[model samples]
Target: MRHIPNALCILRMLLVVPIAWLLTAGEYKATLWVFAFAGFTDGLDGFLAKRCGWMSELGKILDPLADKILLVSVFITLAVIGVVPVWLAATAVLRDVTITIGAITYNALYGYPHGNPTVISKINTLCQIVYLLLAVAAKAGEWAPDTALLILGAMVFVTTVVSGIDYVVTYTRKAIAASRAKHGLA
Candidate 1:
């Protein structure tokens, strides 16, 4: 029972490669189905972890790591196959890279962060996932409209930028406070 959440996360991570491969092979419908299953596992894992008290430190790290790999791989593969716009994919990747670097530096200088997701960060991730699903579905069929995709893309961009800035600002403040405390000034 305690291991269920982490196991789900590991399963999600394992799904990343097939998702990317499907995207690359232009099997948009298959990609969408696989991606949806992976996303479902993501939500289930988090729900079980928090609701059932199955949370562990490794689960903390593995869950988000799996999400990042899945999302990043899908975005990159879609961009390569010309289903998703390069700019949007680049923006998503850049934001993740920036956050990763920030976290690494913070951990080295100030010890590990609590690894909690902020509200805006969570919103940004949701937007990204929604936009990706829409894009993939559009590619899989003609159901989604261009106007909707445009609007969703714009929302994703805005949220990505805002959340990235929020993370930097929040962590910078934390780092500064930690430094001040170490110097006996806080």
Candidate 2:
């Protein structure tokens, strides 16, 4: 029971390769099913971690890593196949990359701050997932509307930029405070 959350996270990571392969092969239906299963594991892992007290340091890192891998892979593949916009995929991927770098820099300078997702960040993630699902479902002949995609795409872009900037500002402030404390200047 203690390891269940981490196990689910690991499983999600493991599913990335096959998901990517399916997307590259233009198997949108199979990709959608696999992605849905991966999404299920994501939620389940988080629930078990919080409700069952099964959280761990490793789980903290692994869960987000798995999500980033899955999302970025899918977005890039979709963009490459011309199913989704390249700019949208690039924006999503860049936001993750920027946040990751900020986290690492903060850790190196000020020790590990618990990397909790902010409300805006969570909303951003949800938008990205919803957009991806729409894109995939549309590709699979599920009748996703063009206007809907356009609206979601705009939401995703706005949220991604906003969240990325929020993270940068938050981390920069924390890092500055830590530096000042270290120098007896706070």
Candidate 3:
């Protein structure tokens, strides 16, 4: 029972692969439903785990992995189909790669815990998702979807840079402070 949320997190990660395949196949209707289901299950597991005090470091780690995989895969699919700007996809992917590498490096070197997203990061994620959905919707020749995707893409770009920098800066400062405090230097 304690592992239930972790299991769901893994399931969500797996869901990304097939959902990307469906989206790439131009199955918007089906992809939409699958994406919705994935989101719902993710929410359900998180909610239940938090309420039951079953949340763990493991779940914290895996949940974000699932989210990144889904978002990156969506960007790739939409870009391949010419629904999204390739530069935007590149930025999204590069940011994820940068952060993941930084997290791994920080965890190994400074022994810092995995930090959850700040509110800015959360808003950035929503913008990214909206950008993806609008791009997917634009494939059917809707101008509104196209316009919204462009606007959201720009916002995603800005937010990505800001959030990524905020994390790195905060983590670096915290590490320094922790080291200083540990040595009676703070």
- Give the local distance difference test score of model 1: 0.89
Any runs in candidate 2 off by more than 4 Å, and if so which? none
- In order of appearance, the predictions have TM-scores of 0.96, 0.96, 0.86
lDDT of 1 by residue, 105-171 (tens): 9999989888698888888888888889989999999489999999999999999999889988999
Please report, as a residue range, the 10-residue window in candidate 2 with the lowest summed lDDT. 106-115
Cα lDDT tens digits for candidate 3, 1-186: 889888888888888888888887888767776776777666777787899899988788888888788888888877787777788888888888888888887777667555878888888877887666566556544454445666787899999889888877877787787678878998
Between which residue pairs do clashes occur in model 1?
A: none
Q: Candidate 2 versus the native: TM-score? A: 0.96
Looking at candidate 3, the ten consecutive residues that score lowest on lDDT are: 137-146
Q: Residue 136: error of model 1 in Å?
A: 1.0
Candidate 3's displacement at residue 118, Å, is: 0.6
lDDT of each: 0.89, 0.90, 0.79
Candidate 1 ranges beyond 4 A from true positions: none
Error of 2 at 62 (Å): 1.1
